[model samples]
Target: MTSFQDKAILAEHAIRGVLPPTPLQRNVHLSEAFGADIWLKREDLSPVRSYKLRGAFNAMRKVLAGDPGKADFVCASAGNHAQGVAYMCKYFQVKGTIFMPVTTPQQKIDKTRIFGGEHIEISLVGDYFDDTLRAAQAYCADIDGHFLSPFDDEDVIEGQATVAVEIEAQLGGMPDRIILPVGGGGLSAGVRSYVGDRCALTFVEPIGGACLLAALQAGGPVDLRKVDTFADGAAVGRIGVRTFDRLRDVSLVDMIQVSEDRLCITMLEMLNIEGVVLEPAGALAIDALKDLREQIAGKQVVCVASGGNFDFERLPEVKERAQRFAGLKKYFVLRMPQRPGALKEFLGILGPEDDISRFEYLKKSARNFGSVLIGLETKRAENFDALLSKLEAAGFTYTDITDDEILAQFLI
Candidate 1:
């Protein structure tokens, strides 16, 4: 059996042919506030803006090692993995076909193309990822090209373990605890395998895409009925079978599930207060620390901020979601009396600190009353209580749609 040190050395030799190790930076703000020495493994700062490149490099290298004559490879990914494979194709001078969902962002497609150059072919197929994956799989079978599994393959897992190897060497030793964000579990599995019993592990998964949570509950991998793609990087419907096998013995309690909205709050907090731009999935480890406050306090901890491929166009939506999750902003449907002075009367009842961000009449449902969607932003969360009390006192019938998913879909 190859020691983790040897595997890491081999990976280092492999990856140096591509890019340098991602930085492991001590987070002053988090360390100061959490009463612990906190560090961030900035995989987001990698060449692919993610650790996916590690797995892609390792897998492609091993494949070529086995059959140097073969030059064709294939993979399907909506984002990071596609770029990883494309970059590797360019590096190895191999021909590869990269399949991506038609709905994937142009930014990602452009990056993949720029990285692969003439070494890769980009195929835009199907609207959903599942469809694109099936298309890629079929195409691989038809052409006899090697298909790369994003997180399930052994070589890929070994490659991702390089993160742990670097972390140990860079930090001078293992941290007391390592909080990891689990999507399909490749990184977590790799780190756990490398760390062994050297350090404790806290695995965080998005509530909407809690594949790890579901797998633990069911005693094996099981498909989730639904997956919310807000945290697109971590929104996996099922944990990879190989990954779950590696993590089967981990205690269920060691895994934490964070709501998508709550993750948005942390992303916004890191960006606004700390000037750190974190994608929703990238904020998982930081957000997980909130749940383990007592356990991690005064302990040396490392949180892997997985990736920062955040689209700035989503910043406003992220801020709105964070505000709502924090209870500092709300949307409500108010049944207003269709009188000349009714809007003025309601406007006067609002607190000085409460600002009307959105006000739109939905439809006149009744002759006397009209339904209006109102969005309110406040300086403090407590101000919302005062506004609600004022509305009640004035006999204004209103329904808070801030937490109502169905209503918010159309109204908000």
Candidate 2:
């Protein structure tokens, strides 16, 4: 039997013929901020802009090598994994059928097409991922095509373990700690297996789609009632059974769940401050550093920046979420008296640094008072406190809807 390290080394050898090893660079800005030596394994720089292709390529190569006549592959993925499979299928000159949800963004669909070129076919089947997955499985069974699971298969896990192999090679040795983003547990499990307690490991997950955390808590894989799809790459509802078996021994204390809103803050920071474009899932490991400041201070730490498949069209939403998380922006419903001086009086209460980004009167028909939807932006978060205090002293009745998800969904 091949040892885990040998498998990883062999996988790396297989991958070297395709793409160069992704860069492992020390991030000076992050190092300065956290008072630690910070390095980022830039899997975002892969050919398909994610570490996913590593697994996809390795798995396909192994299968084709075993049965040279096998030529078809099938997979279900909404984003990165689909692109990975598509790219590999084209590289291997094999036919691939990719199943994706109807709701997948056009950007992803177009990228997948570009990666696969004429060698792959894409089917937009269901409104949700589960439906798409079932359709893919059924089609694979019908055609006798090899079904490539995104994270559940042994070969896929071995392929992903190549990431650890590259990290070790690039860094000369394992760092003090390695932070990983967990979705279905493929990458985390692979890296954990390869490292094998040589370095500390921390797993980060989006709070809304924490399948790994849930599985760890329940002592097995279990479906989450609901999952937030904001971090599409890591938004898995259930941990894979194979992956869970590998990760079942992981201590719950080592897992950290970051809020979706907080992830936005990290994404925006990486873009605006560091000039790095990271998708929501890509930001998980870096965002986790905020929670590990003390533990990693003055230590060498590596955070895997998983993928950079961000859609520029989502910039407005990303900025809005970041602003809301930082408390630099807020929305409110205010009841204003319908008097001549009412508008002026409310305007007068605004702080010098506060700017009105949105204003609309909901009920102009009400003679006594008007219901106003107001969005305020400020240079500093504390300015909102002063603005709110002034509004209260002025006897204006208002409801802060910035933190109200239900109201924000409908009204904001």
Worst 10 residues of 2 by lDDT: 361-370
For each candidate in the order shown, give its overall lDDT on alpha carbons. 0.90, 0.93
* Model 2, span 157-184: residue lDDT tens: 9999998999999989999999999999
Q: What TM-score would every model get versus the actual structure?
A: 0.97, 0.98
Q: List the residue pairs that clash in candidate 2.
A: none
Per-residue CA lDDT of candidate 1, range 141-223, in tens?
99999999889988888899899888888988999999999999898888888889999999999999999889888999999
lDDT value, residue 395 of candidate 2: 93
- Report the C-alpha displacement of residue 94, candidate 2, in angstroms: 0.3
Candidate 2 ranges with C-alpha deviation above 4 Å? none
